[model samples]
Target: MRVFYAVVLLAAVLVLNFSLMHLAPGDVADTISQSMGGADQEILDKIRADYGLDKPFLVQLGHYIGRVLQFDLGHSFFFNQPVTQLILQRLPATLLLVISAQILALVLGVVLGVYSARKPNSIANYFVTFFSLFGYSAPVFWTGILLLIAFSLKIPWFPVAGMRDVTISGGFWIQFWDVARHLVLPMITLSSIFIALYSRLSRATMMETLGADYIRTAKAKGLSNRQVIYKHALKNSLSPVITQAGIQFSAMMSGAVLVEAVFSWPGLGTLAFQSIIARDTPTILGILFFSALVVIVGNLLTDLALRLVDPRVGGRK
Candidate 1:
């Protein structure tokens, strides 16, 4: 059933993305002409026909859908390469950034949340609240810029941008360290928002669970504070946090666009940015399509995780 819904949603998204691209102002031929230093009507017509832009709207959409079903993203006009290949080349970078950022966010957020929830009105709770607000309110691009300047400029702690410096000659470990150095800023920038969200949610839910009847009963039954908090309360408190994790996962995937552009990360988001500049329809649509799929899968995984954590979830119709 989830698969069916995802398919329907993807179909609608593809249609909308394609239609909006065609409907957007400015002729492809005109843009092509400008880029190529002015081509005649014959050349322009051939270009349009070759790219199937000369076809009727419905016909073009039909062809596109057919190609999509076959796992074909078609060729990128600007890049002069297969869209799938371009996406595959960039997918790993984005995945590394997203996965690393989410892991950092999850671990740090859960830790801070648990600690703060136990502390109540202490300094630690206030610090967590302040950090959450700062992360939530700060713009992605701005945060990225600050990190870039602080670490890459004044302090000289990391590289300013790109995934890796292939220019350096070294073995695997040397190259790995170089890439990890470059990844630090963007990952921090991307993960900050997710950390803010998860930490706040965890703190709130944990606080509620700490006050619950079961938690009180556990304390009454001679369970230590650590056991009561971790073994009992925290487990029950995680359902909402788990749900938010799915949502934030999707959020970070989408938010990567600004973060990628800021740091020149050479990921899916950077590819989409370039494609948009050159009006590369195929590449743009392909990125968007794959991104939507990722978000959907993240949500599905979240739902499954929730069921596992608390069997009562989805146990009934």
Candidate 2:
């Protein structure tokens, strides 16, 4: 089954990731020892033994994989907290930002794409195509910086960095609004590329759908333009868009690392970045496996959406 294949592939990727992390030049014990101001050899060896770093590579890996299967990601050397606890705390903020951006991209992308398809050779279509390329090609961190300068510093409309104002503390609603206020810049930064991509994809899909015989027949039978486009063409065109959206969502979740770091947003990406720097293998592996799970689940959801949109796809080999 497709699900079984996906799970097997994900498991392989996780194993490879674990091996590569171990094979990296420095051991976690060495990193910890160095950070602790040149501890004595005996003490360093004790610390290594305490954390199982003194074990053979295969033994360490086996224990790690076993613990992971048991949902025990172990404690973070840097944070002194369980990796799952840390990730769960930060995941919502990242999800809020990315999911909102995705919605914006889908709505704007579909609308602009449909309009461009309706007038393929028109100036509006040309302009949309040109701008989409520019948006897609832009660097996310650079874009975040520009938005920070333009809106946060220059215009003074939003916070320059961090997830929320440190001073605001009252109730859930107050906290939520504060977080939302700071989220605008990073959301826009993340959404820009997706918007461009969705627009281009939607335009292509719509264009193809418009050229289909069914669309022409519907138009010839005297259906209104809106009805023909919406009721018929849009429905069929959505399959591809749904697929792209799923993939894009997965990419955004992983790729938000740079954007989160730039904006100082507390999210899995930032957490993962810090973990990598600190050589916190538990946190790093936790994030890697979590991200893979998200991508797989997203793809599954996309398949379900496709089936709902067009049942023929569900029935096909």
Best candidate, TM-score-wise? 1
At residue 261, give the lDDT of candidate 1.
98
Candidate 1 lDDT over 84-193, as tens digits, reads: 99999999999999989988998899889999999989998999999999999999999999999999999999999898887886989998899899999999999998
CA deviation > 4 Å runs, candidate 2 = 170-172
TM-score of model 2 (CA atoms): 0.93
Error of 2 at 163 (Å): 2.3
- The 10 consecutive residues of candidate 1 with the worst lDDT sum are 24-33
What is residue 126's positional error in candidate 2, in angstroms? 2.4
The residue-by-residue lDDT of candidate 2 on 62-131, one tens digit each, is 8887888888878888899998898889888777877888888888889989999999999999999997
RMSD list, candidates in order? 1.6, 1.9
lDDT, model 1, position 114: 92
Query: Measured by C-alpha RMSD in angstroms, how accurate is candidate 1?
Result: 1.6
Model 1 quality (TM-score): 0.95
Scored by Cα lDDT, where does model 2 land?
0.87
What are the lDDT figures for the candidates, one per model?
A: 0.91, 0.87
Per-model TM values vs. the true structure: 0.95, 0.93
